[model samples]
Target: MKHYVLVHGGCHGAWCWYKVKPILEHSGHRVTVLDLTASGVNVSRVEDIQTLEDYAKPLLEVLESFGSDDKVILVAHSLGGIPAALAADMFPSKISVAVFVTSFMPDTTNPPSYVFEKLIGSITEEERMDLELGSYGTSEHPLMTAFLGPNYLKNMYLLSPIEDYELAKMLMRVAPAITSNLTGTKSLTEQGYGSISRVYIVCGEDKGISVDFQRWMIENSPVKEVMEINDADHMPMFSKPHELCDRLLKIADKYA
Candidate 1:
């Protein structure tokens, strides 16, 4: 069976993949869900995390632990794309394919934060009001993190049912410093990160990321293939778990 490492987005944990994990495993593929530092059940405190490298250590460590010739299909959702890309760069040979699901697919020229800033500029005034960068630190320890505004969870994240939105609010945490880290410079070469195959999954009804921004990222940093799930929101694993699983399995069958 092929191995798949599923990475969750900002403020989310491995728990987000509960729906997709079993479906993939039932189909005879190995699946591992990850919670980055300070996310999900991880004990790492947000105050303790300063750099992107520290935040991504969990994912990097998992990839490094794998023996040579042990390859995986790296699936990243939303902000998880940043670290997944870094992992692919660190172990190009170990990653059979990197699937970016409604996530930022950055390159040396266009990093994650660059794409984020551009998206910020393209949104409407009302959308701008809904995007808040909450401060979670004291004067001595400054922290800038983004969280969706009121009513945004249902509109941007859930798009499935009201109950799912309630669950998301209970589960969601403050995002790590990774988003800010993307604004800074990162070392990613064409041979290192670009060598591995990549796929992009677009969520047609995504309001958090938006289809236009997703398309912009795809155009900026091209991928080998692209897949779209209509009426799917930012959290497709919750909104369209079966369809997401099917598409993922198809990707694994074709590339892994």
Candidate 2:
């Protein structure tokens, strides 16, 4: 049996993996879901998070808890990619494979933050304005984080079934703004993270991170394999949990 450590995206916590975790556990593989500091159920407040390192504390702590002989498959989604990549670099021997689920696969020349900035810049001005108006509002400001309101959240994340959309509307939280502004830290090295197996799972209907952008990331940082869930939105864990879990199992069988 394989050990899978799942990381949630921005504004998300370990709670997001509710569906897939059970499926994986039922299949006899171990599952560990992480909520990065301040994003999920973690007690750390967003106002107290000062640096990117502080935000990554949960992932780092999880890695530290593992024994030397233990290795895990790191599954990351959305903004979780940044910390996952950093963790793979810092503790390559502990990670058997790194999976990017509709997430950025950053390179040394351009880290995940740079890729995120570019993703934001790639959107049309009209679309950007719409997103800002819909998801980000002044009343939710000053904490350096923003939340997606129901409408925006539905359109971007929960394009699956009606029930899934309703569930997300009740659960999503405020995501940090500074996750993409970090600088000066060393980037991934070929001898370190690059040596570990990498995989990318693309969510075809993802409006938040487009299919084209997913392909671009693969082009920049080649992976051992690529998997796709055609009907999924950005939150495939909620939208297409069965398919996502199946794909994860396949990857684990192949690489982990």
Candidate 3:
């Protein structure tokens, strides 16, 4: 069986993969769903998690746990893309393939927020003020609802076929502002991009991040394959598990 490491986005933890994990396991794949240091159930203390480095710890530990010959696949969503790209560079040989689920695939020349602003149109200072008046729950802050955006509320629940909005809502912890604001040590560009294979999965109807943005990420990364789900929105795993699985299995069959 192939091993897969699934990472959730900001303010989310391992819980994000609840539906897909069981299905992947049922299909004979070994899965490890992780909560990043400041996220989900792993926080030593939410505010105590002070930097981007803290966010990378859980993923780094997971990779370190694997043996030299262990075959691992990385599946990252949204902000989790930061760590995925880093880990693949840190331990290239063990990572069979990397997948970005409607996520960023950043390089040193580009900043994460810069790309987001560029793709969806930059958020004006006044807009930031409006978004900060959010209704969503965060572990440390109550203003995360702003990130959800007008479109996030509409399409997030519809992206996947599964009903996971309640769980996602409950797990809405405040994300550390520094992950993107501060800057990462390096990007996929600064590191070796050719060491492992890369794939990009586009959530066609995504509202938080658009279809055009997804294409931009793939066109920019050192990607080898592109998978699409037109009917699904940002939360494809929740709305269209079968389609996501078909594409994943294809990747496995092709590489494993």
Best by lDDT: 1
- Estimate every model's Cα lDDT from 0 to 1: 0.81, 0.80, 0.69
Task: Report how far residue 252 has shifted in candidate 2, in Å.
Answer: 0.9
Error of 2 at 57 (Å): 0.7
lDDT of 2 by residue, 138-239 (tens): 442322465666666666765677876776667777766543444334566877778899999999999878899999999988898999999999989988
- RMSD for each of the candidates: 2.3, 3.6, 4.6
Model 3: per-residue Cα lDDT over 1-256, one tens digit each: 9989998886678887877888889999999998887678884544455455556789989999998999788888877887676677778878889888888677546654345446435545543432332333255633222244433444566654334776676567656543343344344454444577888899877865678777877776558888888887777778787788778878888876
Model 1 CA RMSD to the hidden true structure, in angstroms: 2.3
Q: Over the stretch 52-162, how does candidate 1's per-residue lDDT look in tens digits?
A: 666788999999999998999999998888878877877899999999999977776655456655665677877666556666556655556766555766676656766
lDDT of 2: 0.80
TM-score of each: 0.91, 0.89, 0.83
Alpha-carbon lDDT of model 3 = 0.69
**Residue 27, model 1, lDDT:** 95
Instruction: Identify the superior model by lDDT, candidate 2 or candidate 3.
Output: 2
| Model 1 / residue 169 / CA error / Å | 0.7
lDDT, candidate 3, at 57: 81
